[model samples]
Target: MSTPQGGSSGGKVRGWCPDAWRPMMAGDGLLVRVKPRLGRLTPAQAVGLGEAAVAHGSGSLDVTRRANLQIRGVTEAAWPDLLDRLLALGLVDADGGREGRRNILVSPDWKPGDDTHRIAAALHDRLGELPALPGKVGFVIDAGAEPALSAESGDFRIERGSEGVLLLRAEGRAVGVPLGHGAEVEALIDLAHWFAKSGGAAAGRMGRHAAPLPDWARGSVQPAQPKAAPAPGQRELGTAYGLPFGRLKAPTLIQLAQTPGITGIRTTPWRILLTEGGMPGQLDGLSLDPNEPLLRVDACPGMPECPQSSVETRMLARRLAPHVVGRLHVSGCAKGCAHSGVADVVLTGRRGAYDLSLGQRAGAPPLRAGLDIDSLIAHFGAV
Candidate 1:
């Protein structure tokens, strides 16, 4: 149904990765990510997405920690074809400009008539009206009966209070201000204006900005700490599956749809995927087993896949997982796109070597520099 390129299917040119409209160039190929509506994919849509990836790009599709699907390793000649296929599959925004603006995350557990969907839908239609915020700056609509996006909420959050009222929260704030579900979009846009007015451009991200929230926005209730997602397996939603490092082979996903019981695909900010039904007994590189140790590690494309890295990351991480304690992050470089938060073990790649740090985030300075995977394993043994 589509054409492929001669020689290599992807390239190794890497720099600033684009979010919507255009694909980001990577070592393998061009990466085109699709942010699903409310972060969901119907079974039919999922099949189409997997096929599109196989037909036009690399046979691999990456499920980002942001709950989006990215077709990896596409050649320059194949990008346009990939765009056409994506549009036909209803996987992208026809208007590239709006595509970048429509960044809204909702609780995966939300239902049709629930506040999460209602609010998210309203905001989706009005995305063009809001002032331009940072591409990564996003909203988490967790208005489900129980708050579901405590950890996933980015700069701003619209969540439900214990009393069943809607509250708007800014990241790093201890409490949230009470608002009706009706005010979610307008209030958020106003905050964007507020953020820009307070020198948000100079100091990127809400948490880093020194200015305080506007006077009108005040703490009505203390928000709870975020809890980890439900472990792998069947739940009220469906059977859950985990990818070793959030990578899913497109052909495998295509086959997964052919299996019985599956009806839809839902993803989390984590590397977990929840389908409408149980997965077909076994899937290569996909984990139905909840306790898999590979699930504890986070990694990004390194070395050959990304120009930023000097070493291969995931392969080494996989080898080191058995020796490392708690969560591990194998970042390509200091940017730390894979795991933003701190982890027990972090190995950041730099000029073909790794900087090791304990109890630190990916971007932080390491305790020791220029260590290989063996040293990493030995560090665990020594401690």
Candidate 2:
């Protein structure tokens, strides 16, 4: 595996920061995200995105935890042309506010006209109806009688209860408030207003706020863990794909993703892709084997790529791949965007060196400090 280098960059956007109109700058080039509506990309859209990545940027692509795709290494000069191409492909959202607020996530397995799809589609259309929300705050339309995206990322969710009751679930809370099937959207909109009114200001994500749900709205206390993704290889629905990291080359996606007689592709919070009718075949960078060691790691574009990053992350992770077991997170900085929660072992970069945390988030103070990459690897390589 080749190490990812940030190189020298010219732009000023933070690493992994994505918006439709305002692309973030990285060490390599501009990083622009392509937010597929409901995380579903048509075969044509996928091909066009692959072409756009090649033409306007580096051919590298990332599947985000939110199930959106980011195009990496786009130059400043190519942004306008890239936007034009995205517009032509019906992928660009001109309104920055609308684009920012359009963070709805759906179960990739949702079928047309099903409850998940129906509620999700309705929620998408009604985004404008909700109060002005934090750009990062989003709703998870996981209503399919049973929750398919419970473990998936989202702040608010719509789900059906055990008794076939519809409920509005909050991210931090275990239980959800019940609502009638027809009233879920209105209830969701009301919840948004409540969140904003409760001082969900600059820190727009709901989980960050301390305000509790309405007394009547409080339901269960059980955490909603998103369901595990399909094991790689052929499944009844289709084939699921995984990458060494969350990213892959455009050529790889364009070629391997669009197979003969396939309909569309689905992305997961695991950073894997699902081909509806396609099966797993040979792919150089991706892991067709579900148990691949690299799959147990998480990392971000550090140093040159992210202005906030403190060191190089991907290369160190690649080297540490064989020595570690369970789960490991290599965060460029204190911000643990790669893995929001704790991991079995975390390597956080600071001041060009790394702070090692035995079992905690990257932000937690390291058990040891001022260690170089070599030292860090030697210690944990055997875990």
Candidate 3:
């Protein structure tokens, strides 16, 4: 129920949620987290998690913001057994306690031959080689495609360029590295180590620190183009849905999986669910319209659940949803736990009221309000 220290360098790592939702951690000496590639899991892997959930602390699992899966309710006694099961399913990466440091994002459609996957794999392997590095040091490999978590950014980003070269961005500044199957991947790890050693404060992500890069290190960045989504025949049907405060009931998850044509399910770091091969007519029943107010907003669990949260952020977000435009983030406190990249609008809780900001600019004048939901929505609607 306590907030773990920010970044990977701290102590007594807290689970993502409360015990009822089944929380796990890396160095906590009790619970363990299992992160899969892009949150993709085979049917057998899914079954293994279901069994592990039941046998461990609680029969529950949490889908994290980084498109990874965590099996909660794991106990000290069950760690080895659960790990063995996960390893058998090919879910566990090569590193032992280093799984938390391997945060990589790639196109959901990233296939075997793609350079993106190769680079991501190389980076992950290299991180595994550096056991001394902090557990939270991570990277993202964006293949410049849909259903990708790349837009969220990360400590390092490898974006594809126009001339078939890969553009590397570290701490936000564009750094061009030689393009090859896995050459840039090595360069990225070297950059990470250098950044860590140089006392470069990991500012939430690579892009956040990009502004300070030297001119020569600032390589040309590729223009991001919107690609037409693949047709239903070529692409699998995926539905994005959020779990209130990133917690989903075990039975609900299992039942949701039972729907026909729902072949796979992946979790985004934003506490949303992406189900692939959805039932022919399932989209109609669920409240998942992306343009809808509920889908456009996100909040951290505040108040009773998190002692540090001064207000109930999710309730406020839901109440103010109707007037929200674009993507909005509501944090219980200034920690901004729910977000990795900046949102179009941000509402941070202070005392009994709220402090709001517009656009990407930070530390502007606060739009003080009585914290009334309707008034908040009206203020945002006016913007």
Candidate 4:
């Protein structure tokens, strides 16, 4: 459990994200984010991570939208030991800078030796060759049979174009440049160098940059159709389970890792975890229902956990989840880290009070402002 420090969490608003070496200070000590290589974990690695979480920081973890994991509530003193443990488990990149710059998201459903898998592996190996860009800027490898990560956030994309051709695309652009077989990484590195040299760093993200893509990087092929988002249930690859607000306790993780016949674990951006080779079964502190109301809602760790927040979030979100009719977002602050996209109803925390918005995101003009928790609950209950 986290003890409150009172006042603001006191940090710049949203410049860099937390990584294993450079962790962000939250209300709950520090938040250490870990990026799994290829978004995968052996069953032993999963158990090791669970134990590390219990031994080093808060006995809880957060599954990020980037398909990464965060160990919460770590004190400054414990971070060194925790990092050593992570290195031993082979869960984090040895070089922090390389890990930070390798902001690549691969399709979790990728098969071995498939386009997604091979490209992802190649990119990981060549990350050191790429120039530095903004921390939030990232790449996606969705060159699978069907694009599953198309809707996820990314500034650069490698996807299967129409008729199964491989294409590299900038995020804001509608089309991409076709690549010859095995030339994917070379094109990606060249694009990164271009972005770095062309004043794209000022914009902080490729999609936000105004400069036009190079002429050679243009193509007419549309990407393959995106597959449906994975849901909690059995899949051809494994059994999937959803985490409410992308959070789970250490013991639960240990239990999942120790399940018989489970050989690996795959993390997805949708708050779902795939237990490779495991059968469907009940697990406490996890949801198996696709239609679970809490799954539809997004809430950040507020109050005592996040330094930027003034109000407690998840508890109120839980109480209001069933009462709301559509997608609900209870953001700790205007940044809306939990969900950047629009929601049916967005409740943003401001000056320790709640501001309500309908059919908008957290920063949009609110329908009502400064409502206390009880009144906020009543307002949603009446809706």
Alpha-carbon local distance difference test for all models: 0.78, 0.77, 0.57, 0.87
Q: What is the C-alpha RMSD of each candidate to the true structure, in Å?
A: 3.7, 4.6, 6.0, 3.2
> Clashes in each model (backbone N, CA, C under 3 Å)?
5, 10, 12, 1
Candidate 3's C-alpha runs over 4 A off are 1-33, 54-62, 70-90, 93-95, 144-150, 201-218, 221-223, 226-246, 258-263, 269-272, 275-288, 340-345, 360-365, 369-383
Stretch of 10 with least lDDT, candidate 1: 1-10
Worst 10 residues of 3 by lDDT: 15-24
Task: Arrange candidates, best lDDT first.
Answer: 4, 1, 2, 3
Off by over 4 Å in 1: 1-17, 224-227, 278-280, 381-383
> Which residue pairs of candidate 1 clash?
10-28, 10-29, 11-27, 12-27, 29-73
What lDDT tens digits, residue by residue, belong to model 2 across residues 88-160?
8877676656676778888777888887888877777787777877556788887765567776667888876
Q: Using Cα atoms with residue i matched to residue i, what is each candidate's TM-score against the true structure?
A: 0.91, 0.91, 0.72, 0.95
Model 3 per-residue lDDT tens digits across residues 178-260 = 35555676667667766655555544344454345534335665534435422222234466665554655555566566667
Model 4: per-residue Cα lDDT over 1-383, one tens digit each: 12322112455565878788777778777788889888998988899999999998889999999999999988877888988899899988888779788688999998899888999999999999989888888889999878898788898899988778899989888778789999998889899899999999999988888998888787888888889988899998989999999998888989998999898999999999998898888998788898898998899998978878989999999999988889999998999999989999899999999999999999788999998898987777743
True-vs-predicted CA distance for residue 210, candidate 3, Å = 8.0
How many backbone collisions does model 1 have? 5
> Over all chains combined, what TM-score does candidate 2 have?
0.91
Alpha-carbon shift of residue 208 in model 1 (angstroms): 2.1
Error of 3 at 293 (Å): 2.2
lDDT of 1 by residue, 1-383 (tens): 33322223243343333553666767776678889988888878888888888888888888886788888877778777778878887778887778877677778877778788888888888877767666667778888666767876477788877656788888878688888647888888888789878887666677777797897777767554444686777788777788888899988787777678887888778787777775436777788788788999999988888766778988888888877779999998888878888899888888778998889998688899999777876777732
Residue 12's lDDT in candidate 2: 37
